[model samples]
Target: MSQMTSQTHAIAPEDADRAVIYGFVGRLLQAPPSAGDMDVLRALTADETEMGLALKSLSEAAQSANVNSLKDEYNALFIGLGRGELVPYGSFYLTGFLNEKPLAELRADMGVLGIARADTVKEPEDHIAALLQCMEGLITGAFGEPATLPIQEKFFTCHIASWAPHFFKDLTAQNTSAFYAAVGALGGVLVALETEAFGMAG
Candidate 1:
């Protein structure tokens, strides 16, 4: 239930789309989708693109799914004993380990960005969910900055583009992923869209 803030200009259509992507992905990773969330998604409409089709599928699945079922699936896919079907960590995805140099590097850059861990957060800074939250803040100036697209692009290219898409691909392919498979599809498509959009920038 975090509110993204923006100043200095109108919220572009694309920026809103980015927020939706980041927010949904962050929420999906942070917790299981509630019955209320499923209801909200079911009312959403999708256009005729690959990403839109994926979203349409997500909406359909959410409509048919209940909170308890999703909660159990979430536990299996992300919170199983010892480990889950997917680690969902940049350090794990990039280096085959947790708390590795990628995390160190992200921390150093976060320092530059004036980012800090909340006292309530016990998770690592390099967790994919946390990183996506950071991206949402960057794009929306939720952390009290200019919300420069270039800065957002740099942060994404450095911290996220390296492994998140592959992680999504893996998530999509995992047997335990029912609701999350649609999440993976949307995440992968959004990341690719961001990558291409950034590449088009001068």
Candidate 2:
């Protein structure tokens, strides 16, 4: 899988870092991590911040993670018999149902931003993974020119800040979570950081 980066976009280093974190978390949530993905995770290093601590934990988890076990864990956590332990979708979290007004609003914003879902993707665009990927694209010019910080802040406030923190919290608390617990912790910290950063930008 190709890594997402904003180096070609002339964005700030901080924006590039934001894109990488969004892409990393989004990729892990989008599906089970392959062995290659695990390798990338294992190579990650951290510092002293909360996000760094979470990254350190995730890197440790990746070092010991088995691909097949992760596959099973992914299935159990995201794609069980009918539903998983948690539904990782913005609309569901916001409206207590799937495919609601929030999704329509997102679609409208996506249209205005010239963003379109892949034809191969059957899931709604409100899925958390899709939203994070959209943010990464917005930051890295994957969709077009890199969006301004204000625009990024607007999209994040409308779609991500409203519900993802709660979802990540639930994910961390999930009974079936093991490796994903690390994912949840990292996601939570990332969301908090994003929320604070956007607030400062605003």
Candidate 3:
């Protein structure tokens, strides 16, 4: 009997773009933007498209913001005394509670994808930032193989497709969100782009 073996494919240029976008969004959401992060953001520009406009807006916001102000906003919007204005977790968004079944299912899938939770991270596996990071890893073969389209689509449909765009739309409207409001707008575009690409691939 032949043994089942794994295959690794090099990521195409277009898929590489998805990985970069996912990674950027993941980092932007995972924590407050640092001065270095803001420095890079300050140089960006957007075009006529929604994503471009969002990016351009982000650059404008970043120009007005420093590390301290961005930190304060991050704390206010995502890390208040107990919790923030928004909970960026899939479980919470999908089921209105934390530590729920959605989180459990995501953990199971993450293990199968060889995506172990980082030791320093305390949040559940279904956090939006973590999920995006996972998607980036899958695309770049950080977990193992460059994940096949079916795998990517399966992960996206089960985890992201349901809740993230809703969260982004909400984020963009939050008064406490300035830099992150722009981040949210960009995230909305990203969710759309990934969904469309995945649909075509599938």
Model number with the top lDDT:
2
TM-score winner, 2 or 3: 2
Model 1 Cα lDDT, one tens digit per residue, 27-92 = 888889777788888897989887788889888878767789888888888889989888988999
Candidate 1 wrongly placed segments (more than 4 Å)? 1-9
Per-structure clash totals for the candidates: 0, 0, 0
lDDT measured at residue 112 in model 2 versus the true structure, 0 to 100: 88
Estimate, for each residue in 1-202, the C-alpha lDDT of model 2 and write its tens digit. Answer: 2223433568889888999999889999999999889998899988989989999999998888899999988898888899987898899999999999999999999898988888778889988899999999999888778998888899999999999999999888887756899999999999999988877867
- In terms of lDDT, model 2 sits at 0.88
User: What's the TM-score of every candidate structure?
Assistant: 0.92, 0.94, 0.91
Q: 50-97, model 3: which lDDT tens digit per residue?
A: 667767888888888878887888888888999999999998998899
Q: Which stretches of candidate 2 lie over 4 Å from their true place?
A: 1-8
**Alpha-carbon deviation at 126 in model 2, angstroms:** 0.7
The models' CA-based lDDT, in order, is 0.83, 0.88, 0.84
Q: At residue 155, what lDDT does model 3 achieve?
A: 91
